[model samples]
Target chain A: GAGVSQSPSNKVTEKGKDVELRCDPISGHTALYWYRQSLGQGLEFLIYFQGNSAPDKSGLPSDRFSAERTGGSVSTLTIQRTQQEDSAVYLCASSLWGRNTEAFFGQGTRLTVV
Target chain B: GIQVEQSPPDLILQEGANSTLRCNFSDSVNNLQWFHQNPWGQLINLFYIPSGTKQNGRLSATTVATERYSLLYISSSQTTDSGVYFCAVDHYNNNDMRFGAGTRLTVKP
Candidate 1:
């Protein structure tokens, strides 16, 4: 992809529904990151992936929030049984390297639970 | 855990004005980044100033890693600069990144 791309630019779902958000990182980029922003993203680091290595989920708010990367190019974030509080803009980014590298972000998925 | 702080939680300036935003972290960092979130909520990377200074068009950033602070300078600002600016850093020992609440700038035309 030309840059980090996220699917379902905007989503509206009812409580208790499960929603899946997708992120396609830049080719050859090894690091993928996810962050959640409410009303706007407040810059909270949600999860990150470096190759096939286990993802760092320390920032996930709860078990309801989980993500997986297929191979190393694409990732998905699934929020199960969504709650009204789950409404937020979920962002995905990628970088050619690690922390020292600049990360490129997607437009983000705006999830709204009513 | 490392703490990140951004000064002037909120700012309003006229287009063509210049402003400086600051970020302070609690510990040594190998990585430091600045991002701008536009009205539509998209983050645009401004610089990777883990150390030293770098400039891109109207924006320039400097980080003194040893001192644990970074500064972002926006010169001849425009209405497009209106958005939230964030600073994020990784601890010397961790790969995880943490962020400050952010500085919201509103540039009026």
Candidate 2:
């Protein structure tokens, strides 16, 4: 089975620009999540979606950061007006459900704000 | 919100040796997971053991939910085991998981 996959493994953008990172979860896995990792901040959740229910966007750092999951399989994380501090590796993960389940992860999109 | 703490912070071991990593959480959790982030920035799920013990080849994990801690064991370690190991726990109904600082492991031949 294919594991979780992300697009644009690396992205470099100017400050105040918008960037979108995509994630494809594993087949039959309805639970998808996004996280960010950097030298200053450890791994932190960004959002999670279960089926079509409203996503848990509590982890999003600011209003400029948003994510959407479509068809309950693919998810896109968008960072609007990116800043230098936003530079980090955005990771995607998926599990079977919100219950006790193992989440598979993607290689992640390394975003660098210049 | 939940707080997770990993012990040792860093460890160095020779090939064929054994090591144990620990994770402690501040609150009760409904789910707990272990992950390994390689140098390539790939997050690999190691286990989803909220409770009990599970073993995969030379790697094993034990979670004592009552104690609010988990242990990951690696026996006969290899150079490939070098990486940062993290323990993340999701507080009940939080929908978001909190991760520990992680324990860095260095395997030397």
Candidate 3:
């Protein structure tokens, strides 16, 4: 892919439903990141995945938020029992490596929990 | 955790005017980048400057690593430049990139 790509550009789910957001990173990139942005707020770090090593999940807001990256190429963010406060934009980004590399972002998925 | 701060939370400029946005971090960083989020919510990478200076067209950036601060300069601002500018950094040995609150720029024509 020429750039990072996210799936289901928009999602509307019930308050108690579960939603999954997917991200396809650029080819050969070794790093991936997931972030959340509420309306009128800055980007909030969610999870980060690097090549094969243990993922840094320190940023996940709660136990309901979890993510997985398979084969270091595609990634999925799962939000369980979505709440009204979960309505926001989910962004995905990728970089060549952790150090001294520029990151590119996807268009993002707007999740609306009704 | 490194603390990133951006000054002049909001800026209003007229077309053809010039401005500078600042970002300060609490610790040494191995990666620093500038991004612009347009009104439609697309984030575009502006620069990947951890240290030193670089320029591109009407935009330029400078980062003094030792000083732990970076500056983004916009020359001859245009209406299209109206957006939120964000500064993000990654600490040494830490890949968890953090972002500043961002500076909102409004260029009026």
Best model per TM-score: 3
DockQ of 1: 0.74
Using DockQ as the yardstick, the better of models 1 and 3 is: 3
Model 3 spans > 4 angstroms off: none
For candidate 3, give the lDDT of residue A110.
98
Most DockQ-accurate candidate: 3
- TM-score of predicted structure 3, chain A: 0.98
Native RMSD of candidate 3 (Å): 0.8
List per-prediction Cα lDDT, in the order shown: 0.90, 0.89, 0.95
Question: How many clashing pairs does model 1 include?
Answer: 1
Question: How high is the DockQ of candidate 2?
Answer: 0.76
User: By DockQ, highest first, what's the ranking?
Assistant: 3, 2, 1
Fnat of every candidate, listed in order: 0.79, 0.82, 0.79
User: TM-score rank, highest first?
Assistant: 3, 1, 2
What's the iRMSD of model 1? 1.5
lDDT of 2 by residue, B29-63 (tens): 88899998887777788998999999999999999
Model 2, span A21-97: residue lDDT tens: 99999999989989899864578888989987888888888999999988888889999999999999999988898
lDDT computed for candidate 2: 0.89
- lDDT string for model 1 (A1-114, tens) is 799999999999999999999999999999999988888447677898998788888889999999999988899999999999999899999988767787889999999999
